[model samples]
Target: MAWRRDNSAFDFHFFRFFNSASPNNTMSSGLGKNAAGVLNMTIQEVYSSSENWILYFQSGVYFIRNYDYGGDLQIGVDSKTATQPRLLKRNGTLGQQWTLTKAEDGKSWLLTNGLLGKDLFLGLDGAKPVMTADKTKGTVWGIEMNESAGLPAAGNDLITSVQNLESPPVSSSSSSSSPTASQSATPANSQTAPPTTTNTGLLTSPTSSSANGITSSVEQPSQSLSAGGFEFDWGCCGVGFAGSGAGGKD
Candidate 1:
């Protein structure tokens, strides 16, 4: 089978590959590294900033590159029988080249590795990213541009852009936990505890006020600290704290 370039389907821009089966999960280069120090590929909720990929089309196949580390490594399988994909050094091999075809659903694309005449496709095995001949598996993928990363070098006008895929709704827990102006004005001595690590290994610092829905993971100081020569009366949600000098302490 002759490999044909599908230029209209994808562009030479950075993108995030989201699995239609798991909307929240995207293609990630896991923390695990091989002897070459290259990261392994997995499908999971993005915890850090290294998940973006760039689909660079050349000759007839697309070279799927991990944005942050694409300069040295590209996505490829270890061997013809290997199931898991990894970020390997670009060796100009067919195993690193992938052909993307639009799935029947019309919203997702199927990534096929036509290495050694085997029509293995990139899919998810539970949370792991695997390659298999079964198309019925979680092989359909929806791709969206990494808008924050910006566009590619201008001048390549032949590249066609894919429609923006609907992103999963953001949860309240994903909201920014940065300190507010008032919180920043707190005395230097009144130090907030560092964010605690969750079971999933994500660090979160929350500070919330019951009066409002705003919440944060930042731990407030338990001991009362005076602000502006006035004793502060702390309350739940770290709000409604009154000072004795300005008003009667709660």
Candidate 2:
């Protein structure tokens, strides 16, 4: 699959504003504008240049985010959970240290010990496992690897680690019950979903957004902070960077 993205998939129906910042403050608030305000940011898939890179998220390769819970992986069904992160650490256990294993299809991938359910997602194609806020109990979540960016420098390596870790602007919960922890940060489904803001809103979604660029469509809004909103920096520039195109907060 080739890299194709539209900045108009993010939904702001339940969106609400919690705070309002000025050019002087430059600080973000976790509050929302509506009952369920969404965060403001862009989307860039990870792709590879040499062979198949990790930047291509749709290809099933990515640098694990939030490496604390159970995101580690090894090979085989009998594999056990390891101790550290794979890409960043050196002696991280096998469960924590894994490399992408692309099947003959060149699309589906199998994680070390990941079972989609009781048996793990088998021959899982298109959708790749990624680390996100939902990993409060584990170390990863579902994500499209190749679709983000990075090319040639995809996963399990530093090159593909491009701003992959840089989260967009969002509110953080100071309490142990931080709402951002359980948040999905992406959209859930298509049916009954709100309109996409990526190309639709023209970069005014986040209220912090301007009208000079494009943004990534949020697939899930897995967060709730006193009804306030949160935003993380989904790194992207040039072709699809953050600017006025986003439906940012006003």
Candidate 3:
């Protein structure tokens, strides 16, 4: 499925696929935005190059903002009992901010909320995805960027250009859950639901990316902070090595 910014509707087909109440059993707050907000997605082939998404933080934290509402992936207020994630307005609120950290293995990244220190996990065995303290195999994410998808590194200086934007605000939360236990971040659909892990299985090589001038050079020191009682590095998650455009084999 090719996802182009010029698409007629939302950000490709998955936007509607997940928004609907079908195979994707996850709960949605509400479909707020009908059109896909400006989406700049790219697919890479090799495993290491896929980790090159760190620059997204350099520019500013991203909301995991799905097309559902132009909304963000937020931690529900009742974290203790109902830790289920939701979609909310992109007002730069604390709960919506997320950091993509490089897990122990160079393959997967951990998605942690800025406000709530909980890790995002997809429910396996027909369970709905939720944010919780469970560090089971479900929490690790095997992300990949490739050619099949239409989104690519169309312009140069894509990463640097994003650096100009203001970062999201930091917020405190009552949820002090610690990081979940480590698990192999493989592209396994058995842990996280297939719907959410479709791209995970697509791990490949750096066929292309919007990050042209964004070299694999060292980045500015990142700010360290404590959120929801857990200490973590802000904007300093894992960084990926530069790769060739020809793409490598699986």
Best by lDDT: 1
Per residue, candidate 2 scores C-alpha lDDT tens digits across 31-119 of 22121111111121111111111221211222232111111211222122122112222112222222333323332223332222212
Ranking by TM-score: 1, 3, 2
* Stretches of model 1 off by over 4 angstroms after superposition: 1-9, 31-45, 116-118, 152-250
TM-score of 2: 0.20
lDDT of 3 by residue, 113-148 (tens): 655654443322223445556666356544332223
How far in Å is the alpha carbon of 240 misplaced in model 3? 8.9
Q: Which of the numbered candidates is closest to the native, going by highest TM-score?
A: 1
RMSD of 1: 22.9
lDDT value, residue 96 of candidate 3? 46
The 10 consecutive residues of candidate 2 with the worst lDDT sum are 44-53
Candidate 3 lDDT for residue 38: 19
Q: What lDDT, from 0 to 1, does candidate 2 have?
A: 0.21
Question: 237 in model 2: Cα distance from truth in Å?
Answer: 12
- CA shift at 55, candidate 2, in angstroms? 8.2
